[model samples]
Target: MSALYRQARPTTFDEMVGQEHVKEVLLSAIRTGRLAQAYLFSGPRGVGKTSSARLIAQAVNCTAQADKPCGVCAGCRLVREGNHPDVLEIDAASNNSVEDVRELRERILLAPLLGSRKVVILDEAHMMSKSAFNALLKTLEEPPEHVIFIFATTEPERMPPTILSRTQHFRFRRLSEGEIVQKLSRILQTMNREAEPAALQLVARMADGAMRDAESLLDRLLALEVPITLAQAEAALGLPPQEALWGLAEALEQGQIRQALADAQNLYAQGFAARTLAQGLLEAFRAGLYAKMGLGAGPRLESSEEKLVAAMTALDESLERLLKRSDALALELALLAAFQALHGSAASPQAAVPGKPSLPEFNPVRRQPPGAKHPLPEAPPQGTSTPTPTQGPGSRPQMAMDLTQAWRNVLGVLKINQRAFFREAAPHLEGQKLVLVFPEKASFHYQSALKNLEAIQTAVREVMGELEVSLVLQGEKKKVESRSATSLREGSRNGPTPLRGEASAPAAVAGLTSTGSVSASSPPEQSAQSAPPSSPIAEPRVAPLDEPPAIAAKTAESALSSPPLPGDEPPWPDDEIPEESTEAPSSRAQTLVDDPRFQKLLRTFGGRLRKLVQDTPKAPDAEGAAQGDEGSDE
Candidate 1:
């Protein structure tokens, strides 16, 4: 019997799963006879680079009428058996040397022993030394008509530009978990192997979208005599099940601190690996979020993981938060930290999550008014704190004295509660109105900011007292070739905390670990104090950086619409995301979010982010008036 199982091996081009685009391009190239001298296949491991290379070798060597290997043909059979003279396979990893490449170059010059073309397939090509790549460049640069090279590597970035330039590069994408599950389930059905739904989904996820990974996992499932469920698989793989992770999150949310710690210890005691525990719980948190989104019968789930999956469907802002973190390393770290937190251990310096988490802070700030003139009076005299009913479109805003202070208050509230406006805030103060400026012309980027305008206005009114609040949003205008221009753009870090201001921000740059410093990289704060008295209808209300970002934005917006102060700094430039105050390179220090600044912003912004564009340009010289085409098409 063959060492490989029939179900585990992909038999045809059509049967091959995922990598659809890669397969399509190759098939077109082959059918059109547009094959090149060399090809480079690169992507993450388990993502089909090597498999695709082998398929290409077979496609070219096949002596049949179909686009697939005919199995019985001499070339096809030889290729399948790993003995095709024309289909030369090499492990470039161990054989990475100048001499090895030289020898291969000599072989490439010769004609095929059996098939019409000679295909030299090199796996892990990135492992080839620089000298080796240099040696092979000449031959690879100009190979004979009978020669073709298929190079595969998990890391394409490591490959030299000279070598890369000569090859037709095809990026093999990572397979999504859903696709992997479909492929795995199909393979099991064809093999007549029974699997619990939980078992199957677990296997697919474990594959991380690599077809080969799914195959290997399927093989393991079949190898077991008994039926597989999530529990059994978790035991076998030393990874926590979805329930374990969900339960941990629930525990954290319910304030069951001891329970969280106990569950974490139990997981480790149950033989789960640290890395696996960290990542698995993180993923389960995301999955449970999806489950929580829907109320009734949860979306179809693996019978075993159904309960776990149902908990994830949350159709709210939290879901938005989950969708936002697309980077691999960030996801990994988030999960890893959750594990550490569950373990009752202090967050590793490496984790960098500051001491003040978000959930607890959400409530206290929500209680404050949008535009209250006086301080939040903690216990305002019964109804006395009501906004002193304002007259419309008037320049005489009663709280004019507190405008800057009110803006500072509103900015802080907005930063924590709602981010949409906080995101593209180049707000200008126009009388009592707060006109928010957007970075782009599209409605999508401006959608959120537009939606909560009323809530924001109310928030502003609560803080600034009895003034008309008109939310004006100006998209990128085509004011071409202006004699000169002045503007303020906002910037933020990728972390949870939105920057507060110059006062709340960290040093310009600080080294990461031992490497080069991680700079704040945000647009510098503009000062409300600088706006001239000639500003529009009102007087200047407050100083800059003394208040939160929302308040700053309100004040800036008021100032802008109020009137140009000639050389004075504008009123409503969004403050940057707050930094964790640190003497060293740690993102773990207490952020301004833990300070009074954090509280004031949440109260001021009215608890809703009407708008936010993740990436926007920096207004570096807006204060300097040294404007060039900076951040656009955000």
Candidate 2:
């Protein structure tokens, strides 16, 4: 009388409809006298776990039947009445402390007063604390004779491994829709009540495989009306009409946006919660999707196979993305997105069912014929342009000089493996070109960059609008090889020279200027002995071009003695000839005369220089003095 679920709860294994597997196991154990000291019953809620535990207790202590529970016996009747002295039931949720477990341990050790054996049932056993579980562990492993412990929990994962190892685990399953409907029908017959078949089916489906929830729903319906119908059940439960949900599915399949929105608004107008509507739509679509994939269609799906597949696939995808938000706006948006995706021309097969290749991806939305243009206005031609004031050079629109920002943006969109390669590349902007340069040695990276050129461009466009770009390897474009003069000679002697190769004149001059002393072929001892004591090569010397002959000679000696300026480029374009010995000034002059670069320098200034052997710098000085004396006398 308290409620249909409590009043009609099964008292024996035979009366329980679902969980046949568990019933068979418990029956076999009782028949064989293989009863374990501790047993764990685990599964989803409202699936007869507590009822099964009670039945087991009654079966073991009943005075009548040896194999099963004698429901009419004094022991079974006392168990059913919840007044059995020998059998104990504990709600572990509220009393799960170590003290409670210890008290139970003290009581469990006592002999049965009114039954053959003492039995204990602990419901929600997973709620017990670690210490409490440890306290119960020893009793569970080796209990006194004629004492039994049965543990029931919806969550077995929370139980300790030691507890599980000491007991036998039996799993209870949720009742199916058919099983729930059968149980509800049996209850209705017992109460001599009449209800529509559709109402019972709706209650079962809404129960979500829980028999107690279905019974509770049925009790609510019974309180509303003695004889219930589908309409009254729907009204009492606040469920939207199945007809309306079916209509919404039809609207989606037909690509009727106005109808879909109007149907949803109407459902809300009829007092259905937004969340309930979303769940209903999800179920309907889920059933259709299953049917499309050759899975069995559920209780009610009115739509045809062809249209159902498309509509359900679209709605299913949209709901997954938006169902977490159970508000009206979220539900509306989900419906709209699904509709548009199913009805739009650009929607691809992959977009329809992402990550599923077996489901053919075809555009469900109707499209216009090719070359059919709309009446909208077209843009003006490129020649008809408008001019604006020019931006300053520094402020000009171009890719950034340091492409760290752009590269990061680009890498964000690329796949993981591609990002590693692109990270090593350096980006620079030169005029209209966005150049990505890699080291010459990493040819693979250069090739990969080229391979993913389109993806790179797409990312760049996303980040920096539109721009032209180029790929470059560091030393690819400029055909310059940096080889030392010695290396050049070695390569020439060891291998064939490449086509169009030129030994740079500047490089040769730089080499000669760097190696200012005697050539590498000269012996160190002989080279040291060849230098004269006053050769000016050892002592510092300077050459002053504007001074008199004697003074200029001394300055030149000082200038020549100092080491050649480090890395100074020679004015001429070839190597200088080396002297056999720096013993005499004439010998040095002769060496300079024989050098091709020095001869070229002289030829370049031939018209400006004059040489007279007899009339030297002294003669010019004497003439200038005579002229000055004449002027003074006058």
Candidate 3:
């Protein structure tokens, strides 16, 4: 095995391929004779923190050493062999207690046995307990001239601030992909090995910025014969091919549960580890996002052109972002559950609950709810089971639907347009009309859907049963008038006021009235003459900014002769109810709601309407007045 391939560990600082900045500082200290009593080295794994510490020990104790370390020297050889008496390498992870640190402090009091400096290398120093750190604080503040402490940790944040402040800290950075690739190539060339650059690149990528990892991976590859290919790289790394990943995605897109499950099963059968699958899925989602995020036209998915590349790109981006936010274990569990639900056996009486996916307690993970129901095309009402998709790429699913189902389909298309309002107002549907009683009429009248009757009806009638929807605007007419209000009011089967107005709410140019009880029996022309042209105009008062805009008050002061009760429709005078008129009591009521004084009138007359007829008095003139009017309202 040695001859076949041995890890060519760094024998000197120069041989340490990456982390040039770290090597320069350490070497400068050795050359300048300005070494610190304690040092901290922090970086990702396989970046040579421990190896550098070893090299520093040999450099400091060298009887006959070169710029970094002379492997030929006895001290250097001993240090490399891990048996140097003067140097101690401790795993802080294992001996992280106060007692352990106390023992080391006692050892530190003694002089160097075999070498000039007695160096203690504490690996994973971040794991040291608080008391252990406190126990060494005094010694660290004023250590022996010959004693040196090197603390190495992957996570610096975990270290105590006091301990960190005492030591000289050096940060280690990961080797970039290109750097790793170059180093791997040089290593392979130095060994007189033959390997494809692409294969080497693959190994470097798998290393993910760790030079040590890349080197070890290269050694693993070199164990086999030379001339490595992409297939060999994939197989050795246990990563799936890109095609398999795309297949998984395609199955998910189509909602082909069975095929998707079978594919997942095949992956497990073919030694497709769950973590590996998770990584592959992540990559696919990332690629999808990249392709979809482009606003301009792009290449379509070659495998499934039914979706424009743009559409797939969008889905990919969303899925990629979602996947990245979670853990690998979580992702794997989701994949397995999806596979099991699609391919695993359906409910046998003895099986676990049907429809719901069960993740193993051993993996003990939460699975995301299965994706939204995909709308598959319905067959032509007969023996056919497969219905083709309505070909258009979308982030959502589509159904092969006919015109008959279009209405319901359209409403489904809308789904819950406004959940808050629908949740509050849906239950109000009664008979053929749906009423929304708002606190202020302005909001109801200004509602967009109500203004655009055609669009609202089209959106609603598609999903809901055939019905007429009335958006009865109550309270006051909105200050801002538009098509939305018009749509709602136009469809109103019964308005609390007339839809058409003789004039705008505040336009009082025409009507004039006497202060005395204006006769309900007076004609419009005679009423117009009662007040002169010089009569002061009543300007429409606007509601406060904080309050919802108020509706235009109805012109009830001049129009209402009969009094109104709370929630009651005021009766028109006997001769006033026009024969064959289209006005509804509700329409008339709408006009009343529009009037600013209408509410006040209702309160005043309510007691009279609710009272029983206690006494009957006959006035001779009342006989003619009460002759034919159906209304008895006073």
Candidate 4:
């Protein structure tokens, strides 16, 4: 007539399933008669806390000669039947008030009515009010020798510290799955019914370490009056079949989002609740994770450990929402989101099918074919005067305009000062080498450009793949004169000027001045006088100064028709120089300032190149010239 859990409640310590430590302590106290006045039992529900309390009451008052509370004794029968006057079981949840505690205190002072001692069990003791706890604190601290108190609660932390400190606290733990299964097996044997081991294990898992819940589930299944099977257990619990749950898990593991969703929808159509499906899937994933980790036995899963963890986490987070709304669509959406998280949207079944055209992958960079030239304006024919839009006073007509445009683009990405310094140089590409030619008089710009040569080379590489860069100063007769004067002054201060093989001034300066016929080996006086007022370095500048209007027209024709000068060569052997003219500093400065790129830079910075000053040739001092002649004779 009663529930199976109540009919099969544990009445003795030996009959209890777990909590060995709690039992050992309590049993020793009872046998040796060293019991404390108060005891606190705290743990999760259904782990024999209340039963242990009842057994203590029966044992302390038993009339047996040995194993006090012998199940056959009259005192034990009286307590078991709830008829003993010396023993009381209080439900603290309902009678938790100051008045209830005062009444209990008043009754505690009286002697036992039927046994040698009085036992009081307060269940769910944490539910008592603050005032009630205060009222009972005094009695619990120093109670009569004949009175024993036991408090059981699922949440002992809620109780006041003052109350917890006055009693012996024993924590009860949840029974493992094996222990619960063993207990269920004995219960089924007592009921004279048969059940599959899997059915019992399922019942134990559903109970979640609670023996009362497991017994209640087994009771429900037994009412069918047939041998219990896995299917019957699942049906009785309103859970989907294990096979279907495993199928859904497999689909998700294989990245078959559509198939998994369809399987879930089918389960929903068969009257399975959303919460039930989610719970079942959570268990399946947990089992698979455990099996992969070698923690326990479970179904073989091909999914990686990370994916299993992700799937489990997804189901767990969505379980609360699923319970609140009970919507099947929410579960499906959670599955889809989880699949996408593990393997992006492109991992859908349709994309994995063979012979199907997949979407093109995205590539951020566009590469050109080998030997293909950039789209640029065609070079004008020989003997033509027409100039391309990119050509200016210092620009060469035969050089491709792409290099100039690329240089402008590179400048756009550099700092303002770098752009300003390098803007004076003309860009020319010969073969695979890039040349930046600075004006003869713009020595400051050329030196500044050289210091930042690494930055310039990097920018060049970014625009035009892998190309060598060279910085060269436009050679001139004035440069040669300055060098001769400098050498004479240095020879007078230090010793005679070193020969070509000896160390000299900076290599870059020597490389520039020696481009003319006056080599480093030439004596200062002779090189200064016989430097041939017109040297090969002056050829390009002479053409521009002599015939300005026909320069662009003759640029291509002269390169093809003209022969090399006697001492003509690249200023730096590593660099290639395009045919260029050394226009006056003022003219060259005007050409750069008027350019659209320079104009844009000026507008951006709100400034201008106010004056273009050319360095005037200082006349050589008489002493230095005399010293140079003496040094040449020596």
Q: Which candidate should be chosen as best, given TM-score against the real structure?
A: 2
lDDT by residue for model 1 (1-634), tens: 5433333556457767787888888888888888888999998887767767777777788888545665567776678678888887899899999999888877877878777788888999989999998898888887788898999998899999998899999998888877887777776677676778777777776777677767776776667787777788877766777677767676644556668667767776666654455555546556544566653222233322332333333212223444555343433344334434333333356454443211100012335544455665553345454443353335334434344454556666565546545555554555444566666553554677667777677766665554555443353353432312322111121112233443332221111100121123433332222111221222212222323344334322332233222343322345755544555433333444456655444323311111111122233323311111122111
Candidate 4 residue pairs in backbone clash:
none
TM-score of each: 0.48, 0.56, 0.46, 0.54
Q: Return whichever of 2 and 3 wins on TM-score.
A: 2
Q: Rank the candidates by lDDT, best first.
A: 4, 2, 3, 1
**Tens-digit per-residue lDDT, 390-418, candidate 4:** 34543443344545566777787678988
**Candidate 3 local lDDT, 552-582, one digit each (tens):** 1121321333454346544444665535536
The RMSD (Cα, Å) of candidate 1 is: 27.2
Off by over 4 Å in 1: 1-7, 66-68, 273-280, 295-634
Write one digit per residue (lDDT tens) for candidate 2, span 1-634: 4777888878777898888888898899999998888899999888888899888888987889889997889999889878999889999999999999999989988889988788899999999999999988888878998898899999999999999998999988878998999999999898889998889988998898888899899999988646898888988998887767767866776777789888998887777877677767767666556766678653344445544555556666666655566666877876876666556565455675543112111112345644347644454545764543432344334324225555677789888877776776787765445678888877789888888888788877776556666888776744444445554654333222211222222222222222223324455455333322221112212112233444333322332333334443454544544436656755665555565665444322211111111112222443453333233223
Say which prediction, candidate 3 or candidate 4, comes out ahead on TM-score. Answer: 4
Estimate every model's Cα lDDT from 0 to 1: 0.57, 0.68, 0.60, 0.71
Where is model 4 poorest over a 10-residue stretch in terms of lDDT? 607-616
TM-score of 4: 0.54
Which of 1 and 3 is ahead in lDDT? 3
